[model samples]
Every structure is written in structure tokens, then in C-alpha cells.
Target: MLFALGFYTLQALHYYSPYFSIFAVIAYGLGISVSADFVCERLKSTRASFMGRNLLTAIGAVAAIVVMVFTIKDTPPTASNANLAGLAQYMRTSTDVPGDFYDYAKKPSYSVMCSWADACKLQYLSQRAMVSSANQEIGIKGIIASERFYQATSEDEALAMLRSLDVKYVVAGGRLTVWHGDISKIGISGANPDKTVRVLKGDELPANKVGQLMAARMVWSSARLASSGVTSPLHHFRLLYISYYDSEKPPLLLYEIVKGARVVVKAKPNSPVAISTNISFNTRRFTAWHDSGTTNEHGVFSTIVPSSSSLVFQLNR
Candidate 1:
């Protein structure tokens, strides 16, 4: 099992392989027992000597156990790890029922797109389905779809991908800023069509990792893509909840795929209609986003815009 992935590559993962580690522990244990036995053979066959030998053997066993325990890394390795409890609770009680989803699924459920699909604690706690996960569990197509969705640079393209995947929710944040080292940034050669590496500009992350980084950056930028030079809060996706998380390990942010309210505007024939709106949800971190569309021959233009429950409720006013 150890040789299957090659001796050098097994160290790539932070989590140790149980099979390999167990074998290693057993081999070391046998060696320790043999050493203890050999040393005991040289001792006198008296009661005191027997007692001393037994004591030495017990000490060796305890030392071996201590070494194994001390070498083991803690799961997730940090207290600052993102908390999925709040997001899980919301997914369980609140999300859209089974009706807004596909026909095959009859039970009340929703699919979520997560950053680390392999760590399925969120799904297990919430009892929800995932759009895709690591290791091609949902198939290679699902992984491809997920990668395309994450790497998308445009909101329109991202929305289309989400809609196609039938993902109603998104799980972003939690090590989204991870630098995948040299292996991740190795882009396929544009000229050769072969697996070739390209020289990327300084601090330029790979295409696959850009969206994850952007998601984390967006949260810090007050739910807006300021770094992208955009003033819009993600129009189609609304932030439903931000789980309890640490500074270094950001919280898992839950977003609902929303169909913004359709608003029609009237203008002169062949005139351009400038559209803009102000929005805020978690806090009064208000931001305005703008868009423009040309009016049709009827001097009318229709567009979808984000609306909040607070806007309709009198208490928030």
C-alpha cells in the first residue's frame, strides 16, 4: 500500500495513512519487544532479576506507546478550524424543500457546492446532498463541473453553471487562501497541448484556485468583490449565514441561489437605461452595484435585481 503511491508522495497529505502507519507501528513494536527479550536473557534467573526484567519490559512498552501518541497529528490540526455547526443547522431546518429541486429526489433536500468536498462533515450533519466532492465520488463529470464553476470569472457564467448543476447552496471559506504549491499552478501548455508548465506572473494563483481565494476575499471585502473592481454584492447569490470561525481559518459561508426580483424600466426608444441598486444583509455594510442595458423598440427594458426581506418589512425601516 505504501509503495502504490511511491514512498516520496505519501508525505503530501497532512493526515497519515492508517494502513501504512499501523504497519510501521507494529514493526517498531516487534523490534522493541525483541530488544527487551534479548536484554532480559543476560539477566540472572532469580526472582529479583525476573522482576527487574518485567519492569524494564513494561517501561519499554510505555515508551513505545508515548512515541506513537506524540507523533500523531491532531485531526484538522487547529482550534481555529471553521465551524460547520451553524451552517449545518440552517441546512437542516431552513433551505428550500425537495420541491425546488430535481424530480428524482422526492425527500426534502438541497445540494450544496463545497470547497473541500472530501471533508463531508457538513453534509453528514445537515443530511443534505452535495453537487460534487473530491476523489470523483460523484463521478469525473461532477468534478469537472465543480472545477469549471469555481474557476469562472463572470457572475453570469457562474450562475449558469450553478443553475445547471442544480446547486441551491454554496459552502465557501475555510482555507480558501491555501496555496497549492507548484503542482497546482502547473497549467497545461497552450502551444504544445501536452502537460506543460507555464511561467505565471508573481503572486498569480492558478485558475482552479482563484475562485476559492476570491470567495474568501469577498467576505472580507464586506460581501462585495472590491478586488475585482466591482461594486456589486453577488446579485444572484445571497449570503444566508456565516458560521462561527477563526481569523486565519474563515467561517463557512452559506449562500442561497436566488432569482432576483424582476423589475421593468421604461425609457425613450433606442435609449440606454442605467440600472443600479444598494443592498445589505448581515449588517448595514451598504454597497451599490450598477448595470446598463439598452431599451428595446418599445422603450422598455426588463432586468432582475436583488431584493431583501428587510426592504419589505416595516421593522427594518
Candidate 2:
């Protein structure tokens, strides 16, 4: 009983020392054995008492076996540990991370921008820094900064935000598209095609082009984009792009800007394609693109090669 009481006290105190629990269980079993022996000696003269005690003990043994069986049957496998191991392997093998980015002790020097859960696991398993984790220990400013970085109107803005946070690598996986409830309240709507609106505070959004230009300068001067080189059955690479927003519905007009490169656009089959370009234009200008043609059954379309221009695409209703 004392051992049991101590075990409960330790649990209440949140001291989950496994060795201490084992010792307590052993002491408890000894105490029960001694007590049972004393009781049996006193009741030795009574056959009825002995029979009752033996019957109760047998029932308790059977009940314990039943409970143990049920517990063993219902318990799920430890799949999360396996997943973490796999992630660690992936991070180690990834070519996207530069050699200098492997330094573990330096905070904010090299960190991954990803979902809270992935950030935590990657940080632990990879022994690298992460921008955010399951806990919001980075605080409101960090959260706001991350939001601005993802929803930036241009590459320059996004790069500037990454520089501010000292984030070296951007990781994208299944978690990137997964909808996290209430994330919209924090100005981070997930990659769901239906949820297109992105909100930002005045301070969070860049006030002028000067700051954006500075950010772009920093990116060109310091950082270099690379691929993770991780391949899976579903996709060729685990890390897609450095940007945070979805590829299908790019958040900004800057994303559509391609220089001497083929641009691919996907939409619902047979949807009309509207393409346009203007140097001094924002995302709003894309809405005015002239209708080109209806997409085929594959929902894919190619753009005419352009040298330097601000391009936009919209599906006609």
C-alpha cells in the first residue's frame, strides 16, 4: 500500500522515472505477498475462508490476464518513432542542405521553415534549428514574420523575411498542404484550392519597395537555392520549392514571372485560359487577361516564351 501510494505521488508530481516505478511495483508485490501470507495463517483453521481466498485469487489472476490481453490487442504500434527515423534519414541524405548548414549549436543560423509538427521532429532528429515547433515558443512576432514571408507579394519580400529569421533552408512535404484549423486567423491559410484569401497586418506587409529591394539584394549576396534530392513513390522530390505558397494557386504575381522558360498552368479541364503581362502591375491585374483557349482533358496549358515580363493566369468561368 505504501509503495502504491508512493507510485501515485510520483505520478502526481509528473516524475516519470521508469526505474523508480519498477522498484515501487516490486515493493508493492512483496507487501501484498506478506499480507496474504499473514491472512492465510490466521484463516488456516477455517476451510471455508481458505476456499474463498483461493477462489478470489484465481478470479483476480484470470481478470488480470484478460485485461492484459485486451491491452496488448488494442495498443497501436509505435509508428511515429519509425517516421521520425525516416525523416532523420531523409534530412541527412538531402542535398538541399548546404555543408555549412549542418552546424547544430548555432540558433537562427540555419533553420527549416515548415509546419509546427514537422519543424519539431526535424529539429530533434536532424539536430538542426527550426523556425517554429508544435509549441509557439517563437512567440507572436515569429509567427507574424513567418506569415509575411509566405504571403509575400514578391520573391524579394519572401527572401527578405527569410533573411530576417536567418532561415537557410525551406522544407516542403505532405504537411505543407494539410489544413491546420485556425491557421487562417493567424494569416496563414493552407494550400487548399478553396481557401484563397490571405490576410496580413499593415506592419507585416512591406510599406515600400525599398525594403523589398534590400531583401532581394541580401538573397543574391548570401543565400543559394538547392534541392533536397529526396525521391518517393508519389513525387520525385520531398522538397519542392523554396517558397511557402502552393504551386497550383500561386499567392503572388511575382511567381508567374518566368524569364526565357516554359510556364505550365493547370486548371479544370476545358476551362478558358487568360494570360497577360504588365511590368507595373500587381496580382489584381491578372484578372483582366484576355481569354486564350480552353484547356484540354489533361487540365494543362503552356505559355508563349517571354524574355522579361510580369505574367498572370486566370481560368475563365
Candidate 2 residue runs with Cα over 4 Å from true position: 1-85, 95-108, 134-144, 174-317
- TM-score against truth, every candidate: 0.48, 0.32
**Residues 1-317, model 1: lDDT tens digits:** 53323222322222235356545554555555666666666665566457645776676566556545643532322222336655665666767654532344474344677755423565555556676544322323423454445444567877777776677887775343111221222244211243333334653466554544334334544354542335434666666666654645455677777776666777786787766666553324445555566788978776555554312211100
* RMSD (Cα, Å) of model 2: 15.7
Residue-level lDDT for 259 in candidate 1: 72
Top-TM-score candidate index: 1
Stretches of candidate 1 above 4 Å error?
1-82, 97-109, 117-119, 134-136, 139-142, 174-222, 226-233, 247-250, 267-302, 307-317
lDDT of 2 by residue, 1-317 (tens): 65445434433222223355444444444444455555766876576457545764555445434433433332222225444444444454542453344444444335555545456665655555566665423434434344344434455455556666656555433323323332332234334445554443553433333223222212211111111111101111111122223434322111111233234668888777654432222222211112155678988776543323335533333
Best by lDDT: 1
At residue 290, candidate 1 shows an lDDT of 55
Local lDDT at 228 for model 1: 38
